[model samples]
Target: MADSADPSDTSKAGRAGERLAGAVKKAAGSVVGNDALRAEGELQSEKADATKEAQRAEAQAEQKREEAEAEARAEELRVERERLAAEDTRQEREERAEADRQTEAQRAEAETARKQESVSQATRAREQETRRDEVEAVRERGEAETRVRDEEARAEQARGAARTLEKVEEEQR
Candidate 1:
């Protein structure tokens, strides 16, 4: 079976027992009026007191060391948390900047597309106007040609009549 007693607790108990025994011995020596026994008891009591004081000092030192270590760990955790938070903030900023850049690029592309469409529409309108003008000119030229041919035929008929009249006049004479 394992011993359940802690060493530090056992030592403390042993010191307490020594202090009690010393007190009993001092009382017995005083009752019996023995100087040697009284001196021995006093010495034992002083030794026990000194040992208890030393143990208390050691325990206090151990507690202080543990407290310091705990405080250091807490500080380290605080610093780590702050670093992570800063990293997250930086990442968020980058993402937002990228999103803004994409939005601007898309807006620019849309504007360019709109301008191209406007230019194409203007080109088509100009082409239609030019074609209409050419067709009108062609029609005017065809009409002018037909009029010149009619005039030539009428002149030829007039000359033929004149020649026939001159022949009749000579025969009558």
Candidate 2:
């Protein structure tokens, strides 16, 4: 029977045997009609049972407390993991936002450069057109001056010819 009995059960049986022995001793003293001894034996049995029950209740309470602590630790770890994950997500979002901002800035800069280039090209074109107009004006003025000089020289030559003819008739007469 000892070989078959679990250690915890054996310990409980040993405590029970001790309680039984005390009760038997009190009962034997009461057999001669000693009422006090019988009453004392019953009281002792009640006390022993009460003590055992109290011990059992204490063990159960301790076990429950340990289980509660384990559960609390698991919950805390879960919350921490969630917090870390949220932080990572927030960081990722911030990085993406920063990248978007950079891209927008670059695009705006490129647009501004393109506009400036167009404006510069237009300014150059205007300057070239103005120079061409000035050259044309100068050429037209030179052509007009040449025409006026040629007309004056022709008139002087005709006057000289008429004067020579009048002198020659007068000499001949």
Candidate 3:
């Protein structure tokens, strides 16, 4: 449902025509020296002028409204873009923090591994030292047992020579 009168055309031409007719009538009345006709024509012209002024005012107000609406829409878009940018910045920071945390965890794990390897190497060195000590002690014990057996054999030979000498002397006597 559209109105027959379009808003774009506010009938300024119609008001102009009325104003011309009133001017013509006023000039004819003045030539004839008719006071009433001249007065009526002047009033009509003034009325037409007032109507034109009112229409102009209305158009200006409508333009202002449209401009205000456009400005509001632009402001809304700007605010939305700013919010999205802030969210993007926050997300980027969170991602970086998470990456840093993961890197730190990896570093800690590597340090723990290094420490464990050092402890393992120390334990291995101690076991080797203990094994060497045990071997040396066994060798020393074997050497001591050999010296004791040699001394016992030498003592038994000396006792046998003494007994044989005593028997020879007794037989000679």
The TM-score of predicted model 1 comes to 0.38
Shift of residue 29 alpha carbon in model 2, Å: 4.2
What do the candidate models score in CA lDDT, each in turn?
Answer: 0.59, 0.56, 0.60
Q: How many clashes in each structure?
A: 0, 0, 0
Would you estimate the TM-scores of all the predictions?
A: 0.38, 0.40, 0.40
Q: Candidate 3, 58: how far from true, in Å? A: 2.8
Per-residue lDDT over 1-173 for candidate 1, one digit per residue giving the tens place of the 0 to 100 score? 12225433434445545555555556556656887776776777666567656645665566567557655765665565555556667778566556655765576557557755665675566456446534543454355446545766787888888889989999899
lDDT of 3 by residue, 45-142 (tens): 67665665565567557556755765576566556555555666777856655665576557656755775576567557645644653455345435
Per-prediction RMSD in angstroms? 62.5, 62.8, 62.5
**Candidate 3 off by > 4 Å:** 1-13, 90-173
Which candidate do you rate higher for TM-score, 1 or 3?
3
* Model 2 whole-model lDDT (C-alpha atoms): 0.56
Candidate 3 lDDT score at position 61: 72
Give one digit per residue, the lDDT tens place, for model 2 in 21-117: 4465455445447777767756655554554555455645655675576557656655655555566677785665566557655765675577557
